[model samples]
Target: MVWSALGILLSFALVTAVHCIFSIQMPSSLETVNGSCILIPCGFTIPQSLKESLKLPVSGIWRNGSRWFTGSTDIYNSSRKLNEIQGELLGDLLQKNCTSVLYNMGSKYSGTYYFRIETGFKYTFETPVQINVVDILPQPILSHARVSVKESTEVELTCTAPVPCPQQPPNLTWTPELGSITETLQTDETGSYTLSSVLRFVSSRSHHGESIKCLLQTQQHHSVSDHPCAITVLYAPKTQIEVNVSDPLYEGSNVTIFCSADANPEVTQIRWFREWRGNVSEINRTDLTFTMTKDRVGFYYCEAENIYGKQNSSKVSLNITEHSSEDGYDTLREGNSSTVKWLLGCCGAVLMLIILLTITLCFKRSRTRSMQGSNVNKSQIYVNFDKNFSNLQRESRDSECGVYSNVSNSQSKPASEAIYENSSI
Candidate 1:
């Protein structure tokens, strides 16, 4: 009890030195992660006349704005409990310290806060402290002057990404490869930056179904892209169809009519029609497998469709004959049939070559991937030119593996003798 009385006298003596002026020390700003606690490093000097005794103890309050202190919005107070707020003063006022702690930081906790101290001798209000709470940013926005255009026409598309902090702006990216890119920046009243990119390009039929995307990237390496905005390039189909029928189309002979279309946005549907007596009827279950009959011979055309509209192919007529030369139907419309046959055969050969190349590429890629998955730190193997592939003894760090390699050295052997240089594994 004597020690307590001595402490009280010491506090009273300290309170005798305080003046009207107080200095508040706070960092320029502070950043806090969501769902965490933050320490607002604060220090003050109140003329060293601060006495925090039980009879007339010094009290402090933290506010979220520059409003006058009335305890209505005090986040750190002992008597105000109208609402639940997790904060407290963690510094000794007698020692000229006013640091505080805030728990469970969230978006609502972000703002400029001021500290006010009320003592028996005097009161002082500190400068505001700014706080920023970070979370996943909002998605970028995409806009365009025109989303659809005709072939060779000009159009402009714009993408905007909002950066809540003027000091840190998000990176923006575009897709589908456009031309004449322009950038602009704007700041809102709240001192946030918004970056925009404009892509000026000429639309082509090839870009009908293509999409342009805008990606926003943050310093944390997190990225989000705008929803795909498909460009609708309008144009005619420029359609053409092939009628694959026997040259003669003789009675009782099989014939096939194959139709192909090329258009912007890729013909949504194909319609086959047989026109007779100036009237048209849709042909279903039609291909190159139909038997040539009187009813089957006529002018057939195909129509292709898309968002813009539909286009009709040139009509192709097939005349069925009762007789056929032993060599089959005539080659063409009075053209050489052998040349047509040669052209078709050449196309078939080229298609086969393409298929072979694709298979080889696929196999090579697969083999490379498999080799990458192997553990090659340590291995044991035996090589013998005369040994079979399966008989080779191989060991790996992970498991036993057998490598089959065929190496031939022609210079060291006769033409009839195949010499193995490093083929055995």
Candidate 2:
């Protein structure tokens, strides 16, 4: 400790020999992130009177607050133990650079600071430097803890984070990813800045019982996060009723129909309904079943009701007939029942048209063949008559057998000679 005091004495003696040529450069203000390190850039010039003091040792010190010359308190000194302080003089005193570094900066290290230079017996203090140390980055706060809405309905949520400075504005983000965000800046009477992000989204049944979180970060990277809130999306009751029946459904047979619904907030009431003979009857239960008979041949359905609304399952008819082997009445399936009759009528019309065309073709073909048969019969009869007439003429000429024989010998001449004789005649 004595040696350190002697070093301070010599440092002041050397500065006393120097005239005023001193110049120091430092930033007016600086920002520091919590739990990080920062460098305070500083440079200084020595006086021309310190020529002989050049061989002397120079000492640099940084003290807390702006009152360094009045011995405010040493935060960093060349002669001080490093374990006693959280700052260091990084620049070399011989080069007139008084740059220093501060580690583990927090709110306690905030406010103005100054640098002091001691050369021999002379000491001088520089101007004050201000530092703004951000201790904690605020987390995002949501306006609503839990939000509930119906399907296809538009809902809104607001998330906000405090901003210490307008320059370093905090950013807000939301979970369950969404688009088309509406952002704004809000300030209250407290003079503190707040960054607000509005989320306008359409809630569906699929998003029920999910979490929505708002993340707040000072920067894009190395960001901080906040807690999450749950979402409860309400929707209309999803009614689905099942009617279980065994085969051979006849009179005085017991049947059970179970009705259920899936919905948020659960169903408050389940209603069973039966429609027969233009009369509507309501039965307040999960199932509506009675003695199956011809009188009970009608439509029945189940309805579920909640705070949101009500929904009904498809109707089932309880029909009893001699050929009705299965519990026959099921809802108009796939909307086919509404159009089946029209489709069948169209098919029957097309089939009748095709049959008429086929009959017409058969009639025309039969008529044509009958006319051809008549002509063929006429030609055959004429041929038969000509052959019979020739036979009769041959039999009648039998009495002139001798003359006939002579005429036959004359007519039996060579075909070419006969043709030549005929040509001459």
Candidate 3:
């Protein structure tokens, strides 16, 4: 009896080890993102011989910590939690394989989960699965400079956000239509990202009530956050102001002095003042056209202001000279003399240039002729040497004939006399 019991015990131990080795394996240790779903994939293999004999129910129970409760029986029966876990089970228990998917994962669902399998033979096996839950919140801020600007001017807007490392970054978007959108940028400091978008449009009365918004959407589901900021635009108009008057005004002559200004919104007011005469006048229009006298000659200026800004013209010196008939005639004669002098100077410069060019050409021609003469002299020297060589050749021929005649006379006196007589004849 003792021997039989030992054999049975050894057989049971071996069977248990084999079952454990073939148990289901979950690909990813459980992980969850806030407001997102988590999928737990389980895979297992059964021995071919026992495939038909062994009946493994696909039902599983998830427990947090040491609590052992059935997911289908306990949670499904409870009215409050039934809707939550029932959807997650999704008919995953009936299948032979131990694979499951959880949806609408919440922070409270974060913990360890255990699976329980029941065989037809009253044998039961259990395995543990661990899970981690993370929280990802959207935090975005806007930063920019504050300044006053006139109407129809442009402004800039910037947006920034933070990102967590080892976690997916969120998507950033801008609203209330501004300018072109910029690309996303990452920083060296962990868990941080920044983005800037420009808003360029003419500021007007309509824009005073408008606001710019920056939206951040976290990757964990569609959780979103928004940041909004306001803008104030100021307008003023005042550019340049100036004073002008016609020249030559007699003591009692009707002289007109005008004040003019340039502005975008159009100058609303123009005031004229004389420092020496202490005369002040308010010109409602842009141009101040009035009669002037010798008293209005010392110094004159104008001030211009508008909704945009304000400006003042520089003090202008106005001289009222005595009017005379010779004054007009003398001015014309002086203008004529100045023109004549300018013409004479221009003509003299042209004549000087022509004379210089003529001199340069004449010098180049003389140099070329001198070089030709030198080449001719070298050719003449070669001709003289050829004539001298011909004269020397004639002298040598005469010497050779004298020696031949002397040799013939010495050899035979009669023959020599005959040869000499025949030659002479």
Candidate 4:
């Protein structure tokens, strides 16, 4: 049983010694701005045999070459010694944390580097990290929440930049500062820290077609900007109508109307509309200009349309009147005077005819009365003559009778009889 236990322990020790070795876990490549600092995130594992021999006051060293035996090119060291690249070791070496920072870096410090530890012994990691230095910081990447933006809607945009030096992270700024800006730190798939600036605001028509850019400010005060991105906004059209004349529209006069519109993507079609006697109708015109006639006497308006929407202009009214010539006033006055003279002549002729008719009727009435009076006088004279003749005859016969009676009676009547006889003789 004792020999079996010894063989089991030996097998376990061989496996541990073969698998456990000095190793490091960190980023393979990194980039930083000129004259700025760089952050190196590191964690390491020591051999299992050396874990028992670890002691206090551990020393961390970083060299600027692939192999440590090439030369004594130590850029950073935890021991008290002047370093070529100024930096600090933030991680605890006892806890196997080797996170560090390098300051005042330049192109001279750009290369592969290795990490080593010393505690009465020495161990170096086989894996190395590459550092790339640049004169100007790289431009930030800009992304939108949506591809198409609409007017008067809430929108968000993100501007991202790599944080090579987390201690002195780069700041992002937007041109025109259109909205509220907020910043946050995020880790990518490669385990690298990045900074993002989020902008939120409501879009407007005025912002359409405007260019926006994101600028990155590094710790070294170097400013870099991305390409300008234009904003496309979808909105309705604004319409207005213009005319050649402002007032005093006349019949038989030529008038022209113009339609103007301000919109995105341009106006597609324009139409003319008219309202007369409470009825609306469309004029058969599709172009910008419309011709007005005397019969088109009412309210007029125009409609402008595009792919987004349509808009109608304000209503304009027109009143048509008879046209009079300013230069022909004297000729018209002369013509009116002649017409008045002809009318007066006709009225005078009619008055003379009425007076003649009244005079003829008076003469006929006087002649009829005079003829009737003369006839009445002739009839009276005839009646008086017949009566007088009869009386004379009767008196003669009576005288003859009286003479005969006197003669026979022979008295005083004898003289009368004798006179009558003498007359006979």
Q: What is the model-wide C-alpha lDDT for candidate 4?
A: 0.81
- What TM-score does prediction 3 earn? 0.29
| lDDT (C-alpha) at residue 102 in model 3 | 57
Which digits, one per residue and each the tens of the lDDT, describe model 2 over residues 1-425?
99999999999877776555566777777666675555677787667766456444677777776564564666777756673356666778777777777766666778787777766645555577787887655567888888877788887888887554454455777886654578888765433357888888888888888788887765422343355767888888999877776566766677777888998888999988888888989876655666677766678888888998999998887766465424244344535675897899999999999999999999999999999999999999999998888767765664568476546746898777756754543
TM-score of each: 0.37, 0.43, 0.29, 0.66
What TM-score number comes out for model 4?
A: 0.66
lDDT of 1 by residue, 1-425 (tens): 99999999998777764553566887657665555556666777665334343124677677775646554356666335542457667777766677777766687878887777766664546577787876755567888523877778998888887554433455778887677888888865433357888888898777887878877775564445547778888785767877666675688877677777667767777778888778888987534457778887788888878776788889988777766474354545346767788899999999999999999999999998888656342222233332444444332311332222212334556644543323332
List ranges where model 1 is wrong by over 4 Å: 1-131, 144-153, 164-168, 178-180, 188-191, 209-211, 225-227, 246-252, 260-425
Q: Pick by TM-score: which candidate is best?
A: 4
- Compute the lDDT of residue 66 as modeled in candidate 3: 37
What is the model-wide C-alpha lDDT for candidate 3? 0.57
Where's the lowest-lDDT run of ten residues in candidate 2? Answer: 325-334
Winner on TM-score (1 vs 4): 4
lDDT, candidates in the order shown: 0.68, 0.73, 0.57, 0.81
Quickly count the clashes in candidate 4: 0
Model 3, span 1-425: residue lDDT tens: 99999999999989876864545565335555666555555544554454564544434444455335443222221113544454344333334455555555678777766545445422222455676667755446666434345667776666665433213445667667656666456543221234434445667644554666766665544333354666566544333434444455556555445556655456787776666656555445444455666545666667877876777677767676777889889998899999999999999999999999999999999999999999899888877777677656745764777577557655767876867754753
* Candidate 3 residue pairs in clash (backbone atoms < 3 Å): 163-191, 236-307, 236-308, 236-309, 237-308, 237-309, 255-292
Looking at candidate 1, what is the lDDT of residue 58?
Answer: 70
